[model samples]
Target: MNMVQLERMKNDKGFIAALDQSGGSTPKALGLYGIAKETYTDESEMIQLMHEMRSRIMESPAFTKERILAAILFEKTMDLKVAGKYSADYLWENKGILSILKVDKGLLDLQDGVQLMKPIPKLDELLVRAKDRHIFGTKMRSVIKEANEVGIKAIVDQQFEIGAVISAAGFIPILEPEVDIHTPNKEVAEAILKKELIEHLKNLDPTYQVMLKVTIPDIDNFYEELMNYPNVVRVVALSGGYPREEANEKLKKNHNLIASFSRALTEGLNVNQSDEAFNHMLDQSIQSIYEASI
Candidate 1:
């Protein structure tokens, strides 16, 4: 599929599910789920788990084509075909789930209340591959833990620069500058993030349109200012470290935002559970998260 088809997919489906976990974060997720580190050492083992998870999701009626508009995927899982027939993208698209690629390499060392993603070399090559694979969009992330103007400016500049490149290539870009939920001054940091984001976006070429995945703000309707921007397609919230229930509570306050949560969305699912048990859990998760989105 080309960019035009991808845009159609986005328009036809409104919600997105983020399943992208890079190498650095995968270990943390495994540990959280009590999966032994050795299980992920063999690349095949991890791939198998991802495949099964996707299978279960597609099997569930609750996670129908209309419910999950798209799924954000890690690089390794991008080309994987489910049931040895449909590519991950095709499999989901059959059910109305557009595919989105996670493009950032990973994060760098924490510096003064912020951390930037490591630079990706030959990013054009990756974008080409994403296009060939029929992915509808791409996402990259950086973290802001405090209200430092210098750090925030740098983060905003880099995201818009990358986002511009992505938009030019015909993929909608999800620019995620996640503020840490644990920050002592989360409200302050979010206020600054919104301001910096708006300023940079206003200066961007009118052709570039992007989505935002930010932390659920500390204050209600804090992101209203951002949603008003013409270039922003939508605003989605990350779970940060919050549990599912708490995350849902906060999400309900903001009528404009929806969820792209990872851990919180999968909090109760276990890889080792029986088929019935697994699907039951996934059903609950989909129900809760879907309700919160609306």
Candidate 2:
């Protein structure tokens, strides 16, 4: 199948596997890993909203100009059956504008009912599908070698299991720090920030900034904490989940140095600030960070 088709059906399994295999194994590491998973919820509602948003995606010219694309947020199962039902192009020899590209079978148990669209080499084999899918730009970010004309990078919502997202999309992740079963929390997310310390500061090649779309009680505290890590590629605080007035108020003290999203879907302002706008605003913001860091 072609890569375009892969993007349509791709999901975030690889991303999770990488996080699980971070090898830190320390209490702090394990605790941070768990925090990444805190934001995860079942994909039922999110999936439903994705379909609605997809129909409306091409509706807005601004969103289209931004190259805003939609992606599947997988939770274990790559139900080819469902994919076929929604857009059978996934199984066909020909991948389409709306088809599945990459998949994260790393943490999945096919015997447990998970089926991968394009199987990848587990155990660090790196048997990537040349025409299947691209990769996530954050974390498992080794796609620069393989990135081609068709290899448009991608970034899925942050997750405890984000290796798959990075593996398939090649884009940095945008985080919502409150609590989701699949995203990184303050401690864990902040902990990962340490990777920047003693590392490449604006010297990581593509870019050195770190892009994390998150919420914070105090942007100053969050911003200040980042100062300790001079190795950061760059930091973007996307904490629109808080009360708009409050979020704006908090960020105002910080300044516009970081590109923040108002928790909007890029289609409209977010209410209750649910992640329904993920594919467009969050996804796009994360992509910006990936490019900026590179």
Candidate 3:
């Protein structure tokens, strides 16, 4: 929390030496634009940088959330119990995230495509504690149904869909800027690079539209293949080294890493959880998109 201490240690290359020291968290898209003034707009290079950081994370034994917080947060030997339920009466706090809760009544695609949504914190086991704050889900269903009313088709995370036939899914294909692809040894992938992973992941997504994280060498080697995906929308920092839509200018200044809003807009609506405001926003964005689209 102390900027002074952080600044002091930042000079010690050895401190962060264990991780992807090659690329610092990265200047945000806006910040990059501000600094580069030019040349930073090259997305190919930024893609490589993302893989570099991912490799570092995968290679480090110390950074894993399990290992890093093992001492207390989820101590291997301690009780993992927290108790409360929504069976009792509940009241609205009105206090919520997002200054304005925008409603997106976007037209949904009833076409049975694998509409990939963002992963929710609901890990299938624990009941979300923030049930009182559930608002997004109600909105999403309405949108999906609305999409159905139109002739547009859609589906959720399907195996395959082709051409404009894939257009009606009520979801936009989002991009994942980076992914952790450790080798069989669970270390940084050396013999195999980003390409192999991309090649391999290319098949994993039933929808065929996915954000891939592969090594740089892989991208370099399989440049043709990566560039050739029919529906892939490569992850680009919406505000980073280049303009999201333009892709021809420097990122804005002094910013560090941030999620791509365009990607998140679609990823966010996939689920609803009691505590996450982003999830609700995604949901509403989906609706808003549909409403506006229709």
- The residue-by-residue lDDT of candidate 1 on 1-294, one tens digit each, is 255445544354345677887676776666655576777667678666665665565656666655566778888777777656445556455665677799999878887678888898988999998877877789999999777777877888888888888899988899999998777788888888888888887787777888898999988878877877778777888888889899888988987688888888667777677778877887788778877877
Name the lDDT value of residue 293 in candidate 1. 78
Quickly count the clashes in candidate 3. Answer: 47
161-270: candidate 3 lDDT, tens digit per residue? 22122223222222222222222321223223233435444664455443222222222233335544544433222221222222111212212211222222222222
State which candidate has the highest TM-score.
1
C-alpha RMSD of each candidate structure in angstroms: 2.3, 14.5, 22.0
* lDDT score of residue 122 within candidate 2: 55
Q: Select the stronger candidate by lDDT from 1 and 2.
A: 1
Task: Write down the worst ten-residue block by lDDT for model 1.
Answer: 5-14
Per-residue CA lDDT of candidate 2, range 120-201, in tens?
3451332233122332222211111111212111111123234333334344433322212123234443333333322332
The order of the candidates by TM-score, greatest first, is 1, 2, 3
* Model 3: how far residue 35 lies from native, Å: 20
What are the lDDT figures for the candidates, one per model? 0.77, 0.30, 0.24
Model 3 lDDT on a 0 to 1 scale: 0.24
